[model samples]
Target: MDSIRFENVSKSFGKTKIINNLNLSIEKGERLILLGPSGCGKSTILRMISGLETITTGNLYLNGKLANDVDSGDRDIAMVFQNYALYPHMTIEENVGYGLRIHKEKKDVIRQRVKEAIDILNLTGLEGRYPKELSGGQRQRVALARAIVKRSDFFLLDEPLSNLDAQLRGQARKELVRIHEMYGQTFIYVTHDQIEAMTVGQRIALLNGGDLQMLDTPHNVYHRPANIFVAKFIGSPSMNILTVKMDGRDLVLGGQRVELPEMWQKKIHEKEGRGLKMGIRPENVVFSREKGPYSVKVNIHYVENYGNRVGFYTEIDGEELISIMPEDEFAKGEDVYWNILPEKLHFFDGETTMSIGYPAELS
Candidate 1:
């Protein structure tokens, strides 16, 4: 196992800056995920680590040795791209043991390693099949088998599941996790899908517009987001953000007065009536038929049922708010009351886009 580190790393292409002073560390045997939207530099970071892209500045270390100058083939890393890059003319066994063949390892040793990898990936019966004869998932397993058969120091997966269907992606994710467990090598994966990042990564590094936003576990990133961008980006049903003006102990939202939590009220009192943006997740919104501390009557625009839960698409005071409920409970176009709990609410300064109501000590 090898530990990977990048310090003050920057990369550029002509006039465009792709990565900016990015610093990250992947411990030995860690599963680190680089997550962001398209053009956010996630793939750039992965390529830089694999020596495919030259860094404009900064130091990169692999197992405590400088690696920025290392050649891609000498880096002792296996890369799996989105498109399964397999040899069409070679059988699965040949494709998996090609490196060993080129290096001229003992034939029996190569056979043993290939058999073990095929068994682990559940590709044993298809070893004699050519690439064209196998399914997409089977071909992907061949790619994985080739990567693991070499016993490389690290695995760099660049959205390897992106080409598979949703169901296949799910199955492949489980297989990847099983592979990680079987071989405790550091695995660095890149993906634009937040769901993939959340489910696969031990810890995720979030990027946006060439900047690193937050690096944390999925629970902390979802529940205690470092900034508004993270809070808005990580959740499936995006968090609801409302712009409101502070009015002493009350926050004014669409001409309606709403009381603030004591901690938030104290901070607003110190700020002196400044406007703020408050975030609330969809699951936190409680639907009711009675009056509450902060009640809003909303028109139910639509309801989408997905198995066990339903997503109620609605508009409140001209702002969109989605509420998730039990699938069998409600109907569309029904008038309903909604309220969000204080603990579930997050305050952000409108100017800085930074989280508010957090203990000053934490800052």
Candidate 2:
């Protein structure tokens, strides 16, 4: 089993901490993604697992054995870097078989494994070409083929697709999933792209400032964010957060009032007279010509056309809010009523910014 466990592991460069006390586990054959913005210690965590970076404190277990002091070459890990890291002078075939050659494998075994990797990554006809002769996508495939030929127990990728164009990145993501399914290796991918993290990972470990923000399936992270940070960070347009005050059976936002459902009324009755942050995704904001239950009136200030969809920007109180609509039926300066479903609402504590728990339907 090629499982990895980090028990209270921390890393620091002099006095600057790169990874705080972190406890995480990756099961054998699990495809996990370390996702965060730049300088969030995601890459640092990946390096620690690959034995390229030393842990400053705590224990690291690989396959139920302590591996904090293990050598990088003996870790049985294959890594694919962001730059594709291919030897410019080596032909595609030579590059794919380089690891095997270095390990002193028989020539025949090396040739067969190289051929298989080439075919799997759709580089069969380009085997004779050098890295400079291939496109960005092809060179990336060659890099992947090289890693695949190693057949290491652990496969680590550090933003491997960051250099590719959007279309190529999407295609490469699917290829990665197919390859992982075929090999069943413990794949640990690192990326700042949310689309890649959501699609490629079986589970995502979101990090911020060397601290783990949330660790869960993509669906949960999207729909049930743990706090205001996760709520604002995960979504594209991000969840619209507004300061609201509990008033009797209604929540007051600036000058507008939204009646709370029975469930929420009961849940936040204790918080009456106190301030809270209300969260609603742009997609969840419904537009109607006439005012209805829990509706708030606002004038659209700007409209952005996205072909299949439109983004309507408006202001509530003093905070800007956006709503995504399927069509552009309303123009700027038009007054519209918008409301969110009771189950779609998320509430956070004003002081801590932590979630106050979801309603029964969402929970």
Candidate 3:
């Protein structure tokens, strides 16, 4: 078993800190993705694990053994880089067997290992091809094949599919997931792509501003974000957030009374005199052809069609909000009433930006 553990890891250069005091653990054979925006230390974490970057403080453990001082080559790990890092002068087979060759492995053994990797990556008939002759996806496969051939205890991937075209990236995502399933090896994949993080990872570690926000299943990360940054970052079409005030006995936004479910009313009752932010996902807000209770009439600013679904962009009380509808359902420049289901509403403390939900479930 090759479990990976980071105990209060920190990294810095000059006056800039890249990774803060971070702590995490991953079980053997678990596929984990590190996701965040650029410069958020996602790739830095991967490089630290690969032993390419030295940790400034704390210890790294591999299968319960301290690995803070381990050499990159001796870490029993394989890394697939974003650029595919293949040797242009070498043929596919030679490139895949390069590491083993350098270690002075027997000719027959290297040949068998390379052949196995080629078969696993479906590069069987392309053994003699050069990196320059292959397509983007093919070269990526070659890179992954080289790593897979190592048969290491852990696989570290640093945005391996970013160089491919959008269409090819989608195809590669499926292939990578299939490869993980086939091998059942511990994989630490790093990417800034939210779709890739959502689709490929069995679990995700969401990092932001050099801080670990939440580490949970994709569903939890998406639906129950740890704080405001995550709540606004993880969803498509973005969740709509509005500043609200508790006016006497009502939650008021833009001088309009908002109706919330009884359960939610109790949840925010203690914070009645304080400021709050209400969030509603685009899909959770409904548009009615007629006015209803707590409904706000808005002018349709624009409409965007996403094949099966349509996003109705509107201006309500000097603020822009979107309502997702069926593609064939609505038109631009039409007046409509929009409202949110109280139970689905998310309330956050204005000062702290932390969500107000079930404490046990959230914490």
| CA error at residue 195 for candidate 3, angstroms | 0.4
Measured against the true structure, the TM-scores of the candidates, in listed sequence, are 0.93, 0.97, 0.93
Q: Give the candidate number with the greatest lDDT.
A: 2
Where is model 1 more than 4 Å wrong at Cα?
A: 267-274, 328-333, 357-363
lDDT of 1 by residue, 44-93 (tens): 99898889999899999998899989998888888898898999999999
lDDT of each: 0.85, 0.91, 0.85
Tell me the spans in candidate 2 whose CA falls farther than 4 Å from its real position: 270-274
RMSD of each: 2.4, 1.4, 2.3
User: Which stretches in model 3 have alpha-carbon errors above 4 Å?
Assistant: 270-274, 292-294, 358-363
User: How high a TM-score does candidate 1 get?
Assistant: 0.93
Q: Candidate 1 overall Cα lDDT vs. reference?
A: 0.85
Model 2 lDDT on a 0 to 1 scale: 0.91
How many backbone collisions does model 1 have?
0
Model 2 / residue 283 / CA error / Å: 1.0
